[model samples]
Target: MSLNRRQFTKLMVGGMASSLLPSSVLAQGTTKNNIKAIAFDGFPIFDPRPIFGLSNTLFPQQGKQLAQLWFSKIFGYTWLRTAGNHYKNFYAVIEDALIFSAESLKINLSPNDKRMLMEAWLNLKVWPDVKAALLQFKKNNIRLAFLSNFTEEMLRRNAKNSGIDDMFEFYLSTDKVQAYKPSPLAYQMGVDAFGLPKENIAFTAFAGWDAIGAKWFGYPTVWVNRLGKPIEKMGIAPDSTGKNLNQLVDFVLT
Candidate 1:
């Protein structure tokens, strides 16, 4: 049940159109204020390209390969550890993945290179539309929090660096449950943090798989498809999909 990129996109575009149909035809008269809280995946707000760029600088010839493998391995390690009932914080998973990626690619990763790459996560810049959207949420008195796999330290550093540290009330990490996303326990962190019914909160997802996860957790999910990636073929679709945070605000605040 695997789909090529093109096929997946065609399905996604079809699903997107259906998902975006007028509210009267969908969730009839769903009010904007019905949503009281928003749980955001960290990458939707903070851009991660600079970290890949740093990897490229360190490994000129194998940079793209290294970056791709490193990113994949990071999640792979997380999932494997979770399934095995073994737990490690996101930071440790990332470091292990990077080391494995370097070894697999036969590149000599210097201490400086490793340190610089790991440190880049702390210095991420927010996506261009992030601050404005956050302000709109604030104006509307919407509760906002980050529900992500990132450690609190990682989220704090990046939020402070991007000047959005004060925008979020809760900085939730799966570390509390010792599980990664798509795991019900991980999504429960948001539910527990907000103390609101799942239907009253919107989960903003940076990836399609996450959208499915949140939907499964019973939140109205909105996928911020910033990369224009194909939607996953899971049986469930997000309640909505958008290209940026501005669209996200519209989806949540309608």
Candidate 2:
């Protein structure tokens, strides 16, 4: 849906606050066809669902029934459930949703359960194919960076656990900008980080709505639809759709 003028402005402003790029530095370097960076969102950067639910023997509902709602939000449903369940703050909403899902399932979660959940986040094992794909990108000498809403501390810990910290030029977070994806400001922050024009840098996300956000910002976007889900009804379309990061890289290089 096309946002009204007010909504657009709010999204843009929120994006800038949530991203990490310093606005003052955006004008320093060439903003032309310089393919200096390839950016990605962390969740889509790796699949965290298995790790997220690994230890849970059951699924339960709790203080908030938003986890199932969140699952539906991320993956979507065959039919529309409601119109008003839209989330404004994506990160907080996901956390609430996870906790709610755990409670609803009566999984008998404990501090250890929470610890494993948090630790699993830190140690998120990328899909079996991610390493080879990333290696290929490196072989081609393409710069890689992660632009995500994860807190800096959380990202750092996760990077180490995943064993891919050195693969990135740098890992950035929304904390620096204070906004989330599907916001032009966040995309611009990534662009500004490379000091390149929107078209020169490419971005990828597992979520179709995020792909829409990047497209709206004039960046070439790849949608990693591992499950082959349908496109989001957000109007914009991704430049390429692939089943995995490896497929996505091949598409970009081609």
Candidate 3:
């Protein structure tokens, strides 16, 4: 469906799926062909479901709760660190988050379970829609980079494990700046790496909050909402929103 900005905003906040919009409900001064390069949040490129899935398998009853808590703590720690200018690598943050989550839920996490959970990060694969969209982006001469909170080591290992490491032109992980997403310094990596005006680069976000962050940083943004979650109520919206990389590819390449 073709949704105007207000309509998209209303539906999104109402917790509705408005994916596959042929046209974007864009911010002022944003326009077509504004997308030249794409700086993607890591989750848009890497499928993280398996790690959570393993949680479900490992702790059958407490599985879902454990996964949810762990996921939230990971970002909570990142934001806390970013705010205090206390930067730590994402690998450590993920481990610390998992430990906190397990403790909060009173789940006794074995060393083996912890190891398996942490190792899952190193084995992430791309979403099914990613490779095709990437190939299309390359064909059109659109530069591609990862602008994510993930540590460079995590990003590289996952990409290399997926066998698509060569697809990226740059890896702009938060470690380079010691700041996390939603921080202007972190978002600047895209403009610096691509050597393009901020308006000329498209930022693809996997989470609603990241969409708000990229938009605030002055990039035309796309939210790749694979799970069809509601946009965060931050009074900010992405320039375009879609369900998968193919829809994002259409937004950029069309």
Candidate 4:
């Protein structure tokens, strides 16, 4: 019997709970491409809330405003730099964004405040389910790597802090290509690192735009929609969408 998408998702989740899913459920609705490696966007693996919370604590009244502006500027600076052929590393872009954000918000950011906020990225904690899902991927011998706009130092520090440093095979940074996501060169890093067809590397994205970027780059893509945001109006959609890493595992493994 054929199952609709919602029914199929229910069955898959139930099977996961019981530690056994029907083969039909596993095979149904999954991508035809044989995914050999999984490349993850940074946000899906590292929780950024603590950094934002710290911003709030430091600024009190302006914390949320500062966080919002800083976050927006992070991507804005990267894209503008990439488009203008002006390349700085992701860490530099982030620091620039923070300064811009503080200035825009008219918040006097102290040197100590800047140091504390920047250090937060290095000290990020992984999402609660990340360890178990990563363990399963390792057990299955699936190659895993971080395909992110974060600098390699940022990725390494957080992974080591979270005790998952050994989980990944590649620490791909857009700095290598001197570009940012949705940039074809940035996405190509995953294909180059895995030495596999784009179809065989599943790109797991934490944001809708990243999912669209990976899809545009020809990988089978999964969007881990932790924020429950609506799909973008982009012409393409992801191969799958899930609420968290466990659901991402279901899409890739099952």
Q: Where in model 3 is the C-alpha error above 4 Å? A: 1-31
The candidate with the higher lDDT, 2 or 3, is: 3
For residues 126-184, could you state the per-residue lDDT of candidate 1 as single tens digits? 99999999998887778899999999999999999978999999999888899999799
What does the lDDT come to for candidate 2?
A: 0.65
Which candidate, 1 or 2, would have the higher lDDT against the true structure? 1
As a whole number from 0 to 100, the lDDT of residue 254 in candidate 4 is: 74
Candidate 1 lDDT (Cα, 0 to 1): 0.89
CA error at residue 74 for candidate 2, angstroms: 8.8
Worst 10 residues of 1 by lDDT: 24-33
With candidate 1 superimposed using the best TM-score fit, by how many Å does residue 114's alpha carbon deviate from the native?
0.5
| Candidate 3 residue lDDT tens string, 141-229 | 67889999988888899999878899899988999999999999999999999999998899999999999999999998999999899
How do these models rank on lDDT, best leading?
4, 1, 3, 2
Report the CA-based lDDT of candidate 3 relative to the real structure.
Answer: 0.89
Stretches of model 1 off by over 4 angstroms after superposition: 1-33
Pick out the ten consecutive residues of candidate 2 with the lowest summed lDDT. Answer: 76-85
lDDT of each: 0.89, 0.65, 0.89, 0.90
Q: For candidate 3, give the lDDT of residue 190.
A: 95
Q: Under the 3 Å rule for N, CA and C atoms, how many clashes does model 1 have? A: 0
As a TM-score, model 3 comes out at: 0.86
